[model samples]
Target: MDVCHYDVQVKTAIKEQKAEAIVLTDDGMNLTAFWTRLLCGCGTDGRFEPVYVMENIIPLFDKSFNYEIVERESWFYGEYLQAFYTPEANKIVIRDDVYERALAGVALDVITIAHEVVHCIQSIVMRFLNAMQCVEFKTAICSNDSNEMQQHELQTDRITSLVLSPDSLTEGKTDNEILQQYFINPLIQFVCGLIKTAGKNLLEALNDTNCYNEVKEVERCAV
Candidate 1:
């Protein structure tokens, strides 16, 4: 069985080996913050400018994030698959139709890019963690590890919304205002609100600027 799917094994590894215990829980917040700061440098300037999808996000993955966008037929994944990140190839593959809709500013398609961006972020951090010798942490992030794939996916979705539409940045705006301002899909905004209600601490931690230590540490060690 894939140990990545089993939180018990990860916990046992952390306990027995005394690892720093960086996994997909609180570290997810840190990962999101680090990437957001790296991409936009918005909050650090004290202005907290909102990130633009077309101008900021697309170019982010294209250039700074070190991932190439490859477009193919929509049915390449046998239909219904819009986009995905391939860690080995370091590419974000988008279906042709989805790519066109994103270019056309379709809300859902545009947000799809954000989703894969999180996947790319997770893959980078996970690889670095593995190199740092968190051997048990390796399989949990495997794309083929069906055990916790859904959990990873859910966290990725939530983190995508947090990056695109942080409550700290968009405070006092109604749902409609957020949608227009952030270019976020309506469903994503709604789910973000629901999660904001369910987990106040997680949201606050992710919005914290100091929470990027994991990413900074990874960069430092990689050099």
Candidate 2:
């Protein structure tokens, strides 16, 4: 198993989802604002509507995933918990308190929701690999005790940080420059590159009729 290749694929999937979300907006004028809300949830003073933000995200998953957003009083644990993604139900649950906080101008909830969205993408990739009968790779991803899972979680955190702090990557800095200035781990570049590729593939797969059934098969396995 080429672990580097797998990491790249996962990261690409994430980037593809983000790109898809960006294009969903009308006139593409809100690109920066959309990312801002997603990353930092800053400056949402009547300027950023959560509904529109969600609308952009929900479509990134193909129909087979049955992605739904529900606001509940408590999801899983309790009030301290903000949100979670359930693979079996194919649902993303946002705690009412978190929603309220966002409504009251809290940016952290936005980042939390985005993090859960990354989990959704992870679930999708895992299911896709399972459907393709890549047993070894699937096992690597699904095994709870594996170091792969820990690294994946860390990678997700890094990607989330980069997305929220776009300035680090886009402020006339090369990937190397950003890495040094931000003190980002060297492994993150590989992960980030893979995410970019996976995102492109995911977007293509979402639209291709031939891949539709394969995606549906993955969804079936999840249930």
Candidate 3:
């Protein structure tokens, strides 16, 4: 991971839940409730936050992405970010098998986890736009247009970098650079895997929000 600087906006962190596993569907409202507390310091009450992750397959239950998530049994995973989020539902998921295994118990790995959390925030913001009717809502989750989703993925990575290292990417090497060059650059395979099983049913638009100006911009970009 590279060193970068960032201000702390979120303070409360999620505590692990004791549930076995929630079904990867909507009926799992109870699980969602538990996750809301563990995830962002708030629940479905309009508390927006972000999340990030880097793994091959992990099950994540985000009301935002409209899906449940879980980790796979992959022994190997390359560098890259894989996140799924729901707009109407308000949830975000990350797969960090690679980053976790590489860093092991190192404190730096915390950033890896934090990166995925940032995704939750992104999903919430977008969903809020849809709610306010600033953007159009869709039943199916949207796919990335080349680097469209990549922009969000990289943003999460940068967010993690700021929390972990505190130095700028302009310094020697950045976590973003190393993760890309070594993990993602040579391996589109990993990203492809995320696309296939990222686990989402993005069948929702925005719920509601006050960002009229931002909503218009979001609508333009979503199209």
Candidate 4:
């Protein structure tokens, strides 16, 4: 499918609760709730403070994969590669420079680690749940088709953002504060702001066939 249809399908999946495996929460829950579950697993106490994902969450979940740092020349992407998850080995390899920056508390680099962790979840948890068989989930994880690849990258980025700084958790927090506290990218924070602002209307539109049809028409025209 083209990007537009792919987008509509994603919205439809989210609305239908077909994305629960990836969201890690029930339908209609805010991103904060999703993050709570993802970060704390089943032992959450309702607080949404940032936690050490590698130390606390991953270990709690028994996903004790090693972080392997390698030279840039180790991958085809070279220096452009921040980090990547190897499903066969169940290990996440980080580029040397990215690892160094993450050690120094660089927000983006830390986010890169979280991004790879999400990739691990996709390969391990989601696959175990049989979610990989779904076309939407498959496309969002490892499809090679151009449209599917875009969806994959988009889903990874969205999951990373949701894990880092959920909308409800951003209350009264400035962009810089969110960056320091959540390691959220400025672009992700801006997009989260728009989504939070439009959330009510977006939910209404999803539930109203007429509104959904109008959105389709707009998408068609734009295409």
Candidate 5:
């Protein structure tokens, strides 16, 4: 789909949700409750259920894995140390620091949670597609290498933008333009290429007519 169509689809999807903007506040309990609704299956009428994995401190990935957690006085970088989706666990784990930041009203921290939620959605779609015999997509899902993982992350980021910033695409901006303006990264070009080859808009695929009732059931619970 072209940028205009993509923008329309994204805006329409966001509008249908009638989502209220998240307001930051000092109330820790309120913030936690809000996030719980956003991430847990409770909001989706049990159509989706993701284990909420939490720890008092950052955890290390298995040594056999290519990713590692790195922490510095200034910051941290690595897969396990940060919030990540583990398909094996069927869970999205948020480290203690990231959770703390969200409670403290760090917008990006909360946005990160939304990003992971998109991964949960993607997992559902992938499983459905795989069952339909989409071998390529199944391969992509099972691949553990860095390149495949990056593709998944970039795809999630694009969907997250659609969910979180539909208003930004109002001025005739293409998806690529919007991505460039707000989320410039080396993976942008490759991610777009992969999406194009798939020949279906993410929203449209997930909103398939056959799944309409199921989707509506989830939305009913969400709202």
Candidate 6:
């Protein structure tokens, strides 16, 4: 069975292994969607390997112009990079429904591609949240995570919003559609690259900046 279509094995994996969440595809191109996410570099790499990205997703109708989304059957634990109480499989899956978006001639399908990818980034950090207990890993951890898993999730959503702000995507597609599918392009040029904050915050790494900030922020905000 295709990854886009939920089959018995996939269903069993999600059920028995505790798949966290499944996002709807912008179109039936969920595989294309995820594969597109896999290419971590804005430009091509010499050897052509994504340094960091979501798993098994790509794009299909980029030049064609189409968009859609998919949904998960149930909610499971685990954040971005780590699994909480999940069973065995250590990966994420996004499903693409058969709907394509088109405002007669407009769609933010490209940007939404990145937006959904950021959500996967959220799940990756949630796992760290589970491990770190409570921490804030912003900076290079930009795509990795920001603050507490939940807070970081929300903040990253905000960041994604800012990156794909309505105006940023309005050159061609509708503002609303671009906004819906907005996301930050992972620029290795930024101070917030993934390598900057690797392995700093495990559930047990409370002394780390991300962890300390998490504590301080939690105490300060009372969440």
Regions of model 6 farther than 4 Å from truth: 1-90, 98-113, 121-147, 166-223
Per-model TM-score, in order, reads 0.46, 0.43, 0.29, 0.46, 0.36, 0.25
- Which candidate do you rate higher for lDDT, 3 or 4? 4
Please write out the lDDT profile of model 5 over residues 130-197, one tens digit for every residue.
34332233233333334555555565565555445434333576768645543353245446656775
Q: How displaced is residue 34 in candidate 5, in Å?
A: 20
In candidate 2, what are the lDDT values of residues 1-223, reduced to their tens digit? 5655665665454333311111111211123222333333443222433433444544554454443444563233444446655555656667776766766767887777666665555444434433433212222324322455555555555545544554543467676764453334323544666688799998887779667888899999999
Instruction: Write down the RMSD of candidate 2 (Cα, Å).
Output: 18.4
Q: Give candidate 1's error at residue 128 in angstroms.
A: 9.1
The parts of candidate 4 lying over 4 Å away from their true place are 1-52, 72-76, 123-146, 169-223
lDDT (CA) per prediction: 0.53, 0.48, 0.37, 0.53, 0.44, 0.34
Clashes (candidate 5): 0
lDDT of 5 at 163: 45
Displacement of the residue 104 alpha carbon in candidate 1, Å: 2.2
lDDT of 1 by residue, 1-223 (tens): 5444454564443224311112364443534443454455544223222214334554554553444344562133434456766554555666767777777777788788768766665554445433333223323433343436656667677766766666543577676764553334424555666676669877777767465877788899999
Q: 43, model 2: CA deviation in Å?
A: 18
Q: Model 5 off-target regions past 4 Å?
A: 1-80, 125-143, 168-223
Residue 29 alpha-carbon offset, candidate 6, angstroms: 29
Residues 1-223, model 3: lDDT tens digits? 2112111111111211111111122211222222333344443233222223223112243322433343643211222434344333444444545344434544444554555554454344334333333222222223443243444455445544443433332246666864553335424544554555443322222223346668899999999
- True-structure Cα RMSD, model 1: 17.9
Looking at model 4, residue 64 earns an lDDT score of: 55
Q: How far is each candidate from the true structure, as Cα RMSD in Å?
A: 17.9, 18.4, 21.8, 17.2, 22.3, 17.0
Clashing pairs in 5: none
